[model samples]
Target chain A: MPEGPTLAQLGEGELIRRLGAFAPPGQFDDDAALLGAALLGGRPAGDPPLVLNTDVLVEDVHFSAATMGAADVGWRAAAANLSDLAAMGCRGAVGLTVALVAPGHTPWAWVEGAYAGMAELLGSHGGVLLGGDCSGGRQRLLAVTALGRLPAGGGPIRRGDGRPGDVLVSTGAHGISRLGLAVLRGEALPDLPAAGRERAIRAHRRPVPRFDAVAALGASRPAALDWRVAGCDSSDGLATAASCLAVASRCTALLSRSDLPLAAELAGQAQAEDWCLWGGEDFELVLALEPAWAEALVEQLEGARWIGRLVEPQPWGPLGWTEGGGPIASPTAAFRHFG
Target chain B: MPEGPTLAQLGEGELIRRLGAFAPPGQFDDDAALLGAALLGGRPAGDPPLVLNTDVLVEDVHFSAATMGAADVGWRAAAANLSDLAAMGCRGAVGLTVALVAPGHTPWAWVEGAYAGMAELLGSHGGVLLGGDCSGGRQRLLAVTALGRLPAGGGPIRRGDGRPGDVLVSTGAHGISRLGLAVLRGEALPDLPAAGRERAIRAHRRPVPRFDAVAALGASRPAALDWRVAGCDSSDGLATAASCLAVASRCTALLSRSDLPLAAELAGQAQAEDWCLWGGEDFELVLALEPAWAEALVEQLEGARWIGRLVEPQPWGPLGWTEGGGPIASPTAAFRHFG
Candidate 1:
């Protein structure tokens, strides 16, 4: 008999690794797989490639109906899918398809609110809910499909494209959504300001994708396989995403602890760094760019900050955290699906 | 207080109708909405428009774990989405996105089999799984999004395009899948042949989409706002789909009782017509075309059969059943999500 850890013990990453062997080569390793890489025939040059992604939110797994509203559920699901487009630096989302499964007794207002939330977010981002399916189920579930066009000139920025000396950058704050979830889940903590709690809750409930920020980079032309930048959405914690980038690019990611941008509301929190490292669901982009272009690119985008740098693979590890002098213990904590 | 029927009583279609008011006009009424109907700017003329559709399947509601295998679940879900594209006469499917949510205790083999089934079906249909999200949930659920391309030099044939003089046609047999399900569920029967039962079970377990049959019609040119045909997938029962088309096109559907192509296994079954009318999940295309073109279309496509005709709206109803003599009773039964 075979002896091995179960899926929960093996974790989401391991399961993905095992499943990767069955998928088309080099396709399922990124935030979203590129379609038509070999099938887009007769399409005119300059036609933007279509980038598609899907996300599912289960009632208890992703959000508890006891705490989160239906509108928030819809908004968060859309945001998750949109973040994948941002990871690829797609021009903007053009359309979305959704499937909703819930009990027969579920309120109509809840569903209406869900659609309103989807429409509101997509409209603001220049996208729309084009079509969807709804079915009755024992539990509430929402699945969203987002479709976007790749930038006219630039191809997708993949995790495997990071060079040895690329500067690691990120957009927006980290660990905020996780902190917000803690607040919403009623995890008791030291005396905290009511305003801070509200802010954190809002952050966890509503995340904005960095599509506009990445769209700005689309002006860069693709020539001879040289990309201006490479990255993926850091929804699965900074450490996990960075480690994945490291493994894919065959480089070491030396992430800086002091350079981390903690959420404003998480000040004085003891495990703030821990959350920043492995508290996933941040929906921020962890980008890698040439050191020479980092400063100029940061200047062009808002809320963009440099956090670390990619270097030659070290024998010790592929991921490392450093403060000032030397690398400290690497954090193994990450939000895995089964875990 | 202002009240009529709640979502559960009004059912899925009514809820969609009420919610459709909030969507872009006529967009939510079709199998797949056209994204660039008003936004296709700078896009070359002859480029095929993208067709998108979504379907969700949940445990207990869609299938029972005891009866259905994981692969069957995945294959059935994909077929549902692909059938939507076939309803629109899309040239062919190109890509798909899926979301799977299941508990940690679920067997890893089940997940692998699910993927294998999806890959096998999509590959045979000229499509590939692009990307998807997987998470841990209380109940196993699957959602699929299918993306296809509209045929070159042709526009989509919408359900609302049916004319009063049009003949109603369907690809393949109806009620066969429902009979198959009954067999799988071990419903008591009148000593039906084992071979016939096996065939019905296969139909229910592995339904195919009519993409090729519809693609053949797209070769016909679109001129002066006239179209070759209009229809939708009969996942909601033939009666329900026919009624929807009649409502959309402002015509009455006059269905012929003897014209229905029932499965050979149900030849002597007294309840065969009931299953054909109300037992949904057939995944067959129910098309409406002009009388002049129906003959040619049947000749071009295998297993194509004429089922009914459209007539001017009568005072009594928008859908009617008739045989060699007087009008028969209309079927009020439909497979509703929340019914």
Candidate 2:
């Protein structure tokens, strides 16, 4: 577009050839295009139906950059929030990355490693870096926007899709990450006889995103529920996710207090309630299924477990504690930022 | 999306129901979408034509978090990057945000201010925040990726678009931001005229994106030449921009040094050469056109002047300093950065 006899090289009023070169992942588009960099003192695109979501991660709140590897920081920076798109049943199209660099040069190796890690992650997934801004400051923060496609006819899996007696299932085991965090923080002992410390550690290191499993399930099975944003990752604890989901879903879940899955270390730390209910960063697929299909679905997924069923939303009571599991509220008070 | 359902409440299959409620955007799209988060893990929607650009701004590299208000930081962050998007004639569809938080707590007021600022900019422009990552970090850094459209059939605008006999025109005047920066630095300005200070400061503090202007110029007039990715930013200084543009454009520009516009105070501060070619952050539109259309375009853009015409590219003299006016070699010696 810029290399040819368009714009200045040609005269005004002459038909500028269409910029059909930069191919993006949006199949809906027909040609390649030229990108105008950041707002360059110009008019904006016309209003269109758009989706928006923003996330802010604070040190200690999200990750300790000091303790975390640079590459891990990069990977997590993109993956954590990207999971939201998947949960929304939206296909990611492009990425808008903003990295607020911290003061002092981050080692070239570290910076490149982080970018390399993120690039590898983004590349393997079919995403392109559209354009973004970079700056330095007190802390290193990253804001990434994942532009995605709404499945053509396929709708997004929304929170209001659960049916009465829908059997609850999760894509994989849970509580390991929370336990891993506890182990890392020295709050729990993974040194116990049954503790699989290595497994717990791996769980914390590189969390996997469930785009595949979710997409396959969406396309092949088409989770026929009324909502589309379906089956996204559950990195946070089950209870935390449930609290918000319950309100939107307008349903309650009752997990058999004893049936939730947990690693042996987590089970041992059950007394601390640091594993199953409150512990987070699980990053698994938690699902709601029709009661009729529960057994077969569980059978189909070897590692999956039926935790509870969706009931009516409750004003009070355990939403998943024991078939009456309502929500989690620490006695002395819910989880606080500080000790 | 999180507000409606718990993972357990609605299983993975219900995405269709939720997403179907919304309409898809016009243009390109494919079913295979970017599936994962780390380095592009999702399926492809199929490649569509589009434009892309990115930039990063930090608290210090771009602005001092200490003195600059959070709202200003946020406004500038989006605006500065949006400028890149505008340069390419791209429309912002989605964004990826990575905010590395500082130690302890940065007030919610600050966060709100930042989002409010960005929101105001994005809302007016018609873009959205899809999903991004957040983490704790040492210093603040922002990286943004912008995705845009190019009339359904646009090509990459490279620097090599200009040709000999082309006219030079910009959307607006130059050197205001430099003046603003000088003001911010509180430089001795007994000789500095007062008229240009406020405007320059505003230009530096908030650079409105040039997307609309570029689009309008490209659409209505259809640029005679492109020189897009091929060209750099005003932050790099007009001289460097001209040099690189002319070189890539494979042409030389006989710019009439006298005709170039400069803010009054800026003209008084230093050598006119600095303001003419080396001054930075002007955010003005620069054009090279055939002589015939130059007059018409000049009429279209009131403030523009006959800078110079294009000639064959030279290894050292893209800007025809030997022919007459312009500075030697000074494009800010590259933008300053702490890292």
Candidate 3:
């Protein structure tokens, strides 16, 4: 074994970057990988690109049976993959395959509940359940592969399409899910009103993918402006997601702190800013689009919020947060997969 | 929990069968689930059906690091999924996505080598590694998804297409992988020669998918006969796989004990029959075709062995083994996920 930093020390981003080096170039650097006839630019005119994305949720590591129910685990696992498809602006997932690994002593009802949860979600999104494998393992593991279709004429919204002077808009809020996580962890949300607390908890339990939002935005965009839309999900926090988009597009995102859509009940919480900046599990999409089109899109969508703008590459880094002044000090925190 | 039996008691097959009943029908019954435009049987006139399959390999349960190298684990994981595609007579896979869950202390070399093994196997089959997610878990888990494309004009060969009087063919010798597993488990194989032992170990360690063989078989068939080709991999042993096919097609499989394509070295071994009938991990495909086509196919493909014939529903059962006389006593054993 080669001596080096452990995966916990290297973290998810660096580990993925190192593993990506093992694969051929241009393979693992996308939100949802585009494969099949779509690999080449010519997809036979009418054939839509097939987008594939997978996510695995492990017992204890991703969720605890004591804190989370079996159905929620299954729903969240499917949602995580669906969000990846949403990042690419895919219309909707057509196929869902789930593989479950669990202990032999596991309750049969838990397994059935999990599949029921997945079925319910798929039914709502016009997705169908494909065949999957079942196995016995020491711990419970759920792996979901969501197969989606790109729009016929409109191309997918990749993370590397943001250009200088583009407007950065975010769909919905970011910290609600994170706040909900805190509450789920039994942390007291004393400042939050009852309704806000309930809403945040639900957000954390069932994070919805932004597929409908992206579809509406894509439909309202002008033909020439379609190609410039760049976006990715903020599952790893707004900071990391914004930085990833900026780095991929070779530009800088100057986010206005005041423009963030914070829940009203979180106004008195001191950690609200921290939650918005570094909290994870928020499935909202952060997108960069041409300025005029972004404005039009925001107007078309009910609650789309414009919070930042892309500019020339910055010397310090790809992300800059401003609060009615020059860029504020950077926040170097985000959810870590391993600790 | 509302359960008559735990997952362990129900075993993998019964558990999956019961769980599958919760979802809408027509899914989870095929080797590779067909989705998207393929679901409707109208794939834009010229496009091929999209075939998707996922397989999960768990540490200790599927492979132990002490017994198997990391590369072998990765290779076998991918081969499992590819075999599912071959079962459907899909030409080849286009995209491969892998989700890996391992302890944070896992060596970087192990992960890299695993990816290398997957890359080498995929390179030979014209498949590319798409993006996948990585996370921390208690034990090592690898989930592989191989997306394949059926040949244009012809549809997928389903498990339920086996007709009465169709001849069943085994792609290669069985029990090789099972014997390999025994050897790896430190069991004494006194009768096996060094060369045979090495071959068995290779079969278990780095099993190859039969994509090329299935493609050739499907290609050689006449257009109208293509859809009638029924097949599936014998990962769950010959008896179980044949029984599954029979049950799915509402027919019966009468297997000839003498006609089984057992590895030459495995003959005369006390456990050879048991391994051939119930030893899992054999990646060879079992195909059911019309009697005349099956004979022609065996001639066209070198080393292909005719094992049995599918017949109309029989009173004895869906599966029976004959040894030139009356049906022999059936073996009730198979590789179980939980036993």
Candidate 4:
């Protein structure tokens, strides 16, 4: 046996906590790293900050050939990083660099298809392919680094900027991607409608980054608030995202069970609530905003819903949901790579 | 048997050539991508250009625990990307982002040691750790994206900027790292001195990026030429680096075998010349300069050697060498990932 603790024993969160010690303070606290004017010396004031985010997708671990094509793998990899940039309030991407490693015996067509997928996504979205490196390895992986820029006069939406009475808003319903993965995996979901199944699978394979939501928020922001909103992406599920925001802000998030956004297709499904709360890879924006701003934005933005509120820390924990005026237990555990 | 072609059949160069079509024109044509003032909008005129390079190191492919410790692995990963920055004429790094993928069974100590190594390298050099992502995978890999900056008044040293009459200069000797690898592999070298063996091993494990050499070149540069120098690093052996420069510049590089720099420890080794010409991972700069500037630089910079000159392409190929006033065949092959 190994003499020291293994990654499996520590879990991803603990590992990340320890690894944070090696970086500049709070470098890992945000959804993406913001290289502001201060970091980028000699930059003109009002110039947009550069936002950077990196995500690594490994074969078998993140995806399988049975579930998605090489194109979907590439699209998902790019989407994941773009989603992080959006969470950090980037308006558009500059470009991205991909570091790819694959087995020698991998087909050339697969590589071509992956690039095509990335090209398609970038064409529809806002970035170009900058450059990258390629190498051969036993297992295939793509590490994508995306560079984005905030809009003029916009500021980064940090995770720790929430205040008491801030409203928690979710940009879209969760669990769709999780359902899509299940559909691709051929799991038994007899109650899911055919159209729902199709939507879910597409969501899983080609989840869109929530840049549109970011645009809506920016447009609907109250003049008084300026960019003081707290935000994160629900890539790790709704509960986890809310909890992260709450923990970072030193507040308690009290969510409304009835107000939780649920996909139309998932309305009558038995397991929809559980999946909505805990299923990963939704890639939707979860924001903490002043109540008036959140109310106005939710009214203007399609599919946006006010689901929770921040308050002083409760004795129980950082996150909880209310059902018919009583507090319900919250699940603290989130997705862990090692676990 | 399964497809039209595989990565191994295409090799790294051909694959890169094909992949280049997916990126912006000339994105993959340099050692690192230079984001100039135009690309980074609203930047001041005197501000430096940002240089970006991403390199992926896979376990058992780029490194093995049997040959080096985890800390060395981390150091090497950072060094490889930093070398690319140096080759592109970066004065200093902004920072680096590392995307790491490893198995759950990996010991926590290994991760700690790796970060420690990166910290040590960054502490000595100019960058800080920015941010990164982590994931679980079957094999361990690190994709490091290094961000650097060109000097305020300097421009990028592009691979294709060489002139027909330019002289070729090498920053330092090559093949020490390759010899170090051999020593680490326990290859027998009866005539090798113990100190020489130790030096070779260290060279392989802790190969330094030649930013120092870049600084020296910058300080010694003549005013007339500005920053028009052409250059590349000898990470893929001297012959390959020269050949790339020749091909890119549309000229023929005729090297002087007698003038090749050899390490003092390798003075009497039988295979020293062969290793010096063809061994990889030397991390030394190979520069193209005006004859007068080259002469001056060679005189001013320690261990710098004027080894060759660029001429019109010959019918045979882009690279050749002369020994005893007679032309000798040049090796065309370099390190390849899939091959």
Query: Native contacts recovered, in order, as a fraction for each?
Result: 0.54, 0.31, 0.67, 0.78
**Residue B41 local lDDT, model 4:** 65
Clash count list over all predictions: 0, 198, 0, 1
Please report how far candidate 4 places residue A140 from its true position, in Å: 1.2
Best by lDDT: 4
Docking class of 2: incorrect
Candidate 2 lDDT tens digits, A213-302: 455544444244433232335665666555434544667766666667665555455443546666667666666666544555566555
Q: Write the per-residue lDDT of candidate 4 for residues A68-102, one digit (tens) a residue.
A: 89899989999988999999998667779999899
- RMSD (CA, Å), candidate 1 to true, equals 3.1
Clashing pairs in model 3, backbone N/Cα/C closer than 3 A = none
CA displacement after TM-score superposition, residue A233 of candidate 2 (Å): 2.9
Best DockQ among the predictions, by candidate number: 4
TM-score of every candidate = 0.92, 0.73, 0.95, 0.96
Error of 4 at B220 (Å): 1.7
List-wise, what DockQ does each model earn?
Answer: 0.52, 0.17, 0.65, 0.75
* Whole-model Cα lDDT of every candidate shown, in order: 0.77, 0.51, 0.80, 0.85
Model 1 over residues B135-211: C-alpha lDDT tens digits?
88777888888888786656677888898988898777788888888888788767679898888888888888888
* Better-scoring candidate (DockQ), 1 or 4: 4
**Model 1 chain A worst lDDT window (10 residues):** A217-226
Please give, as one word, the docking class of candidate 4.
medium
Single-chain TM-score of chain A, each candidate: 0.91, 0.72, 0.93, 0.95
Query: Residue-wise lDDT of candidate 3 within A1-339, one digit each (tens)?
Result: 456777887888888898787556867777878764655333475666678999988888778876678888888888888898889878677767888988888888888888887777777765777778888888898999998877765677788988998899888777888788787788877767788888888888788888888787777787665466888988887877888899999998888877976755567787887888777778888899888888888888877889898888988788887554344454565446665
Distance (Å) between predicted and true CA of A248, model 3?
0.4
